[model samples]
Target: MYYQVVKRLFCIAALTCSGMYAQAQHTAVKEPKDVPAEWSKAYAPFRMAGDLYYVGTADLAVYLITTKAGNILINTGLAGSLPMIKRNIEALGFKFKDTKILLTMQAHYDHMGAMAAIQKMTGAKFMVDEKEEDVVKSGGATDYAIGGGVSTYQPVKIDRLLHNGDTIHLGDMNLVMLHHPGHTQGSCSFLFDTRDSSRSYRVLLANMPTIVTEKHFHEVHEYPGIAKDYAYTLQSLSGLQFDVWAAAHASQFDLAEKHHPGDAYNPAVFKDRAGFDKELAELKAKYEQKMAEEE
Candidate 1:
């Protein structure tokens, strides 16, 4: 299962660059139509564990962490995905207007495109890693991944800036932020505890460390330490412990395989230590191979 998941995720990552480039090049106009059908398809939202719900699309991932005070929304997908995301949240018996905070794993266009609109509609305070604040505010214009070129999406104001080891508290929930760079200078992973009936689970929202650009690591002038950052991120992630883990991209966590439609909610499928270890190893191997090729 682990090997199969790794093969599937690696293939998805490998195709991302070509898919993105093709969309950028072949689109007649830069509109929502440019988004691939796979990414834009809507998926029914469902609860994953205590207070945590999957409110994202079939491809892009967005999560809603509920609390007595309000709710925290993570990763808004593309700018055109706002409606579908809202419907998903509402479908799950969640009030979209009650969302109090907005967070993201990274500041990429695809992940944070609808952030500004969501923040405006919910009047939520947008929070992000300090390292990602600039990129988020500029809507990927200041991203090291894009060579500092202006990218798509509307820019947003970051209401709060966070650092590594910082904890975000709301009601009875607490989430510790972990800085995992390389994918983006301010890429972050989050750790929190969620309960399922009698069992307590440590859940980690993993920020992927995949290299998305075609440029060689050393040649990335906008982010000179890309290679070093990835090395540090890989080391940092290995030390953390979690019972159940999920990633910013749904495919990374094998969402479809773990949770089928109308199936009884079982968090056990998410508890795969072997799968996690294998995934990290594969990602590290890919990074090393890229470095070797550049050398």
Candidate 2:
């Protein structure tokens, strides 16, 4: 039953049941044409919470965490996202070059596109989960799920390796890494605390473990533990406790429904524990539906 569930998820969209029982090949995928234009669409950066800011595009989400020592930037959006990100940070009255650390939510092109350039410009150290270090360094060439013998984005060197439960401290800020694999082998979420005038809030920057493979898990020889990893990620996400939450993509967290451009600073808008649970359940149901359909 568990292997059946794993088969259902590992490559839910890869092939039909009759076509299962083969390993996933490291093949090349063509550039997709239907990519959302909103991915690169400029969004007015605004304060999300105490010292935390949203500097990404309308779809892709980039975050900035400020501290006395330096700032931490998460997710770089696209290869051309630097201009917008820089403007967003400077617009918030923060220096763009002051970024001391570069973090990633996932290793996909949309999230990691500008990492190399940004790291070069800011001279910030690029830290990634050890499990994903090779993929990032190979610039997606080593991505078993993505399955391309080519690089999707510019390669960047890793300065440090992060393991599950490691706390990254810079000045007074402490952000903990939660290994939530599946979307990518090393896909992860972040848990941290931030405060404003009202009170302190426990914030979760979730990676939203999405299964992106096109081959069956039993066949995906590149990532042997994908099935177990996805199970762990789902279970881990279900048990997490967070006062407020956001996801790697704005759409995942209903950013529009929560806040609009020029909206005043308020962290309460993100306090949607019920919504988070619903989203998680919906994702589960989606996979379950796919599983049933395939069967």
Candidate 3:
């Protein structure tokens, strides 16, 4: 009888210890509060291909996918960028009021700062991955990337919650969502088909698999499995097939080199298989190096 009582006590003690460890692992990490100035600069909107348009800023990326039914707007840039995005969309001969849906690659302040404002202005339904819904609803306050830092923006409502492999259809266009977490819990990549004058091209709206935290793996309380998630995201990104790819940031796609000042619309420049491969390799290398360092 005494042996059984002692065993029960041990089991309860072990369970209590496990619960304490989990609570500790979920403690928020600190984050920087400054918003980069360059992320707000507006750029001219241009047609990427077919009905797809680049309506984002010089550094931040926003894409407008237009169709007869309505339009889909992706990435809203910083809070100060709403007017620029509205103007850019108008410049492309698209009406902001016609936007039916709003989406984002991640819920970072830089990427989603103007989302709430845009949604309010256009009355568009905001869609996001289930994991990111809380982050979006709280602006940047609840984000794992934000930790307990002072990063935040206007809170936006999530109208639709998405999952991996789910399809978002607007008019004749269909965008396949690829859940590539780690950058943010709900960082997503999109794949779809678009056409230019004579040919159809598979386009990938890539969500980069870059690590943002300076915290070591074990030290990341807000996002405990961030390193593992990044590994999975990198692997998922490498296997994706697309004729042309653009990322969350314009710099990731060599936007300046491909579409310079007064340069004619040439989608061919974005079809660099070698560049994509190099980027993937470099990202993977960085992830590995970070992991080693943390170890």
TM-score of each: 0.87, 0.87, 0.86
Provide the overall lDDT of each model, using Cα atoms, as 2-decimal numbers: 0.84, 0.85, 0.83
Best by lDDT: 2
Model 1 deviation from the true structure expressed as Cα RMSD, one decimal place:
14.9
Cα RMSD to the true fold for all candidates: 14.9, 13.2, 10.4
Which portions of model 2 miss their true places by more than 4 Å? Answer: 1-34, 290-295
**TM-score of model 2 (CA atoms):** 0.87
lDDT of 2 at 195: 86
The sequence of per-residue lDDT tens digits that candidate 2 reaches over residues 208-263 is 87765476666778888877787788889999998889999999999989999988
Local accuracy of candidate 3 as per-residue lDDT tens digits, 154-259: 6787789999999999989999999999888899999999886789989999998777756777787888888888999999888988888888998887887788
User: Which residue segments of model 3 deviate by more than 4 Å?
Assistant: 1-35, 147-151
lDDT of 1 by residue, 138-242 (tens): 567677766245556676777889999999988888999999999999999999997867788899999869875578987788888889999999999988898
